[model samples]
Target: MEKLKESISSVLPVTGIVFLLCFTISPVPNDLLMGFVLGAVMLILGMGLFTLGTDLAMTPIGNHVGSAVTKSRSVWMIVLVSLLVGVFITMSEPDLQVLAEQVPGIPNMTLILAVAVGVGFFLVVAMLRMLLRIKLSHLLIAVYLFVFLLARFVPREFLSVAFDSGGVTTGPMTVPFIMALGVGVAAIRSDSNAENDSFGLVALCSAGPIIAVLVLGIVYGDVAGTYVPVAMPQIADSKELWLLFLTAFPKYLKEVALALCPILVFFLLFQVTKLHLPKGELIKICVGLVYTYVGLVLFLTGVNVGFMPVGSFIGQLIGGMSHNWIIIPIGMVIGYFLVAAEPAVHVLNRQVYTITAGSIPQKALSTSLSIGVSISVGLAMLRVLTGLPILYLLVPGYLLAGVLTFFSPPLFTAIAFDSGGVASGPMTATFLLPLAMGTCSGVGGNVVVDAFGVVAMVAMTPLITIQLLGIYHKYRFRPEEVQEEEAASEDEDGGDIITF
Candidate 1:
């Protein structure tokens, strides 16, 4: 019960914010109050169920598989299996599904498959890096530089979506399980530095989508692009809302099942060979899996049926208002609070604080991430208002973020990059994307050119801010060391202590 409350508290603020934005900004027709109530009930139920499911079902399964894989001596098999797992899980991500649907130029299935393959290939590389003890920062610098160079040639329209892909691909279902897999694999190594290896899986998984999408742009090569304009669905009655909820429920259930099957098969293979959990623990995990399925079904139904339209509606209302300038501050506030609601963000923050022995607190991480996202949202609103090419912003943003990679601690760099994916979770897909689409529609702007990159921007800002915080912590720690050294020197010189 306590644990459930904690989860609800973490999630409610963002959910509340979405509700407020919809009611205050979007305002369903007075006649449609029943529809609104129905949607709200469905949204709450879905979110709660999904949270429980991830905690119980998805995370443990991933962790168990990860640990089992690590016990094997065959490096090639580990790499191949991990790669395939990454691709398969990513292919079933609900947020990525939403993103693919929105992307106008590319076929949804093609983009989905391409992004999955990208994540798979990169997951292998990430696992291999952990196994080989490669320095994450150096690899990030080299890869991102290559990506920047590729960005120069890829069509400008695809650039934002490409970068955005990196962010969206690592969604709710992927983060906990994948991170657990990294921990499980890292734990198997006999090396004294195994802990360090666990930190980079999310970072590596993030790279796959970016590289895949960039390669995609190169392949498409200036083909005429079509932007899929998102239509705002009106709720006429309670029956309509219930029908929408029912329609979305089955789709996500199928998607989650597809996502879970690969891992389950791997788990079964592990059971047949070397690893086995106690029967009781195994049953517990089975229960968790059931919970996970129920939770995801509800969560997806709520977001797709109730939340997405509301987000789009609010954005259109705000952007179309006489006081359109308010959109910037409003977005910033929502962005700040919205990140706190992400379940994965909680996991990441808790892990970072624990690993650092409380040297880095959760509050500090939350504050930094919130601030970073707020700025990104403000910038996104600006992009919608003025049709700036996303590259103009993204090129400089990545350049700055890449430059920071050299200056910050290696772990900070990894965390920053990972946070890019973490920050743009389900809320960004359900709410922020809709908001951008709504505003873009209202303003008569090109949706692809203006609105498409909000997710990219949300993803990018965290890289800069979190790394900057790392830089600050690095410098801040230095002064104390220098002061202690000066005092020691005075003692050696037999000088009298100076009093203020």
Candidate 2:
């Protein structure tokens, strides 16, 4: 019940904001308004169920696989298994699919497969990095350096989408499994470094998609793109609106089913050959899988069917207004409330809190992310207004993030980057991206260059904000260190006096 309440809190603020906008600045037809409300309800239910399901099902599987694979103690086995896990999880990610459909000049499957391989390959690197005790910062620096260098050669049109790919690829479906896998792998080490090493899996995994898409852009040449204007559904009555949602449910059911199959099959294979847990535990896992599938199907259907069109409509309304610049503040406001709505953000925050033994509280993490995402969306809107290049913002932002990593505690740095990836999950992709695209369409901006990087921006800002939180934790806890130093000095002076 508490979880359900929390989920409601996550979804309600965004829904309420939309309602306020509808009644005031961006009113829609009665049927559409009603449909959105219905969607919001479905979203609340879906989020609650999904989060519950993740706790019960998805995370355990990652843990089982991570620990089981590590137990094999063969480098070949660990790398091969981690890579396959990454591929399968990335393949199923709805956010990646959504981003792929938006990108031009590539087959969706081709893009999806490329991004999956990127993630898979990087997941291998991440797992190996932990085992070898490499500095996450060092690896991150080289990879990002390579990413930026590659970006210069990739066409301007592919730039925003390429970066956005990194953010969205690590969505709700991937975060729990990959994150738990990190924890599971890290569990093999009883040393102090285990906790710290557990975090960067999502961070490294996020980078893979960016690099892959950049290469794809260079190779695919002629990746220049145009926006597909959002076509609002025509619904005359409440019954039709309900019918629309009911219809979407089955399609997503099929998608979620197909998506879950690889992971399930892999787990079953492991169960028979390696994991061999008792029957009771198997029954629980099976139950949780069912919950996860149902919840996800419902969530995707509601968000796409209900939220997408409404978001585009609102964006258009705001964009076409005489006070179009208001989109900046409006975007920020939406961003503030919106992060809570992402099912994966809760999962990341909970995992962070648990991993840190509550030193890094979920509330602190959530607040920083809300502020960061607000700024990101505001900047995204600024781009919409100004036609600024995304590269201009990204280079500085990543550099600052890179610099902070040196200053931040290793644990904080990992959590911060992981949070950045988790923050830009399905909500940012489905609602916020469409919102930006619709606004760009209205304002006559190049949607691909301007609006597309909203997810990338969403992904980037948390790197700064959460690291800033780490920096705060540094300062906030400094007095204790100072006191210890003072106490040591006093003891030394007292000893000298006694000797005298």
Candidate 3:
């Protein structure tokens, strides 16, 4: 019961934010009230269940599979299996589906499949990097440089969305399991330095979709999608509300199944081979899976039905307001709260604090991420109000992040890049994207060129902010050591004088 309450508390702020946004911004007559109540309840329940589920089901399963693969004596088998696992899991990510649905002019499934394959290939590369102990920063520099160069050739409109894909591909469904996999694989490494290797999987997996989408732009050729704001439906009666919930239920169930299947298959394979958990543990995991399913269904329904429409409406209202300058500050507020609301951000900070032995505090990470996202949201709003090209922002953003990579600690750099992807989770998709879309529609700008990059911007800013924190940490810690040395010298000098 206490555990359940903890989960509810974790999820409530996000649900509350969605409800608040809906109440303030929704266009439908009764939607604000109806959505507020319904969205809050459903979202909280969903989040609690999902977090519990991932803890029980996904994490263990991913870890077991990862360990099993590492224990396999055959290198060829590990590589083959890793690649297949990567592709399968990438195919299952719910966020990717959301992204695919929003992208116009291409078949949704085709684009999704392409992105999955790209992620899969990269996941294999990431696993291999860990096995070989390759430096993450060096790889990131090369891949991002290639991505920027590709951006030059890709249509201007597709550039931001392409980078956005890199970030969104590492959503809730992907992060926990993939991180577990990294931990599992690293655990099995016989090398004394295995811990150092665990840090880079998320960093490397983030690159896959960017490269895939950039190639997609080349193939699809500069076709931009039109933005349409989702209309909020009024819930006049209990019957209508019940029907809406029922309708949304199956969609999310299918989504959860799709997201869970690849990891499940790997688990099954592991159970058959070197990685067997006790029957009781397996049963616990099954229960967790149920929680995950329930949580995801509720989470998606609340966000899509209530949050998305509200976000779009607010963006439109604010963008259309007589005092349009308010959008910047409002956007900053929204971004700050939204990052705090992301389930994965909590996970990232906790994990980083644990791994770094408190060298990186959760509060510091949260503060840095919030500030970074705030700036990004402000910039995204500016993009909507003004017709500036995404490249102008992205090019310099990546360059700055890359330059920082050279100066900061390798672990901080790895974590910073990973945070970029992790920061823009489901909240960014369901709320921020819709907000950008609505604002773009209100301003009569190109949705693909203008609105599509909010996720990209949200993702990019964290890379800079987290690294800046790292720089500060390094500087401050050095002074403390220096002060300690001076104090030791004074003590020695006083001991020699004695009488004074």
Candidate 4:
């Protein structure tokens, strides 16, 4: 019930915002409006079920598998297990399908396989990083330096897309499983550092797709193509809108089923061989899996049916105007509210709060993500207006994020990088990216360069803004520590410190 309320609250603001625009500034067709209304209803219910189901299913499965693999204590087994787990989860990521379909000229399977291999390789690296107790910061710096070096050589057309792949692969389906796996692995260690180390697995897994796609760009050369626009559905009446969603639902039911099978098979195998838990827990997990499937089908149907077309229409309308500079502020507002609707953001925030004993509030995490996405959308609009190179924005943004990792606390650094992928989940790829593409088309900008990087921009800003929070938290508590110590001298009594 609490999850339901959170889901409603998360989705309502954006719905209201869009309704205000439809009624006042830019009226939409009645069919689209009604479709959106129904979609919002589905989104709320889906989010509620998905979050609850993740708590029940993905969390326990990942924890169980993670600890079991580590307990085996054989290096080859760990590597083989991590690699297979990474590949399987990624192959089924819904957001990756959205991305693959959108990228012109690349065979979907080819791109998907490359990314899977990349994720598999890096999951192994992440597992090793934890076992070896290597610093996450050092690994990130080295890997990203390599990413930039490779970026310089890859074709210009594929550059932003490569970076965007990293963000999309770590969507709602992937994050919960991988993050819980990290926590379970870290649990084997009995030290403070284990908690800090648990976070960067998502961070490293996110990096793998970028490097893989970039390598593909080099081997394939420039497969240049135009931005293929999303055809906004023109429904004649209410029934058509309902049918649109109803039809999409079954397709996703099959897709989500296929997606979950590999993970399910792995779980059942583990249960028989290693876990052997009682019947009650097994029944609970099975029920949760049902909830997960239904919720994802509904959520995907809502977004693809309701949100995507409406977003594109609005972006086209706004950008078609005589004075289109308002797109920046409009885009900023949309970006701010839209990210709240992303399912993965809640997962990341919950984990951060749990790991930090609530020292890092979910409210703070959400705010940082909102501000970061708002800034990103604004920059994306600027790109549409000016046709600036994406590299011009990404290189500096990533460089700053990298430098800040050095200054910020290790936990904050890990959280910051993970937030990058979380911030650009399915919602950003479908609605927000299409919105950018539409606006760019309306404004006569180069859509391929200007619009393609909305996900990349959405991913990048969170890295900087969240790290800034860490910088602030660092200073805010330093003086507080001094003051508390001084006050302790006055009382001559001591207690454990509390700082946020």
Best by lDDT: 2
What digit string (tens of lDDT, one per residue) describes model 3 on residues 1-500?
A: 54457556555665565456545643434645576567657777776777778778887887787888887857787788777877777777777777777877767777777777778888888888887767677788898898888888898777777877877888888888888788788888775446555766776787888888889889989775554457677777878876776788888889888888877777877787776688999999989988888788888887777677667777787777676767777788778867876667756776677766777778888889999999999998898889788888888998999999765655677778888888888878888998888888877788878888888899889999988887777566775664454346335431111000
TM-score of 3: 0.91
Q: List the residue pairs that clash in candidate 4.
A: none
Q: How accurate is candidate 2 locally (lDDT)?
A: 0.85
Candidate 4: regions farther than 4 A off: 478-500
Candidate numbers sorted by lDDT from highest down: 2, 4, 3, 1
Rank the candidate models, highest TM-score first: 2, 4, 3, 1
- Give per-residue CA lDDT, model 1, range 1-500, as digits (tens): 54456556655676677567656756655433443445545555555565666666666777778877777778878888888788888988888998988888688888898899988998888888887777777787788788888888888778878888888888877887887788788778775446545776787788788889889989987536676555556667657656766776778889878877776787778777767778987787778777767766666666666667667767887878877878888889889987776656766775676556677767877889999999999999999988888878877888898889766665677778888888898778877888888888888888876888898899889989998988887677765663464356345532111110
For candidate 4, the TM-score is 0.94
Using all chains and alpha carbons, the TM-scores for the candidates as numbered come to: 0.89, 0.95, 0.91, 0.94
Instruction: Give the per-residue lDDT digits (tens) of candidate 2, residues 1-500.
Output: 87789989999889888988998988887777777888887888888888888988899998998899998899999999988888988998988887887666678998899899999999999999988878787789899999999999998888898889899988888999999888888899875567668888999999999999889888988664556777688998878888889888777887788788988988998899999999998888888888888788878888888888888888988888889999899899999999999988999888877876776778888999999999999999999888999999999999999999766666677887888889898888889999998898888888877888999999999999988887777657865673454346335431100000
Window of ten residues with lowest summed lDDT in model 4: 490-499
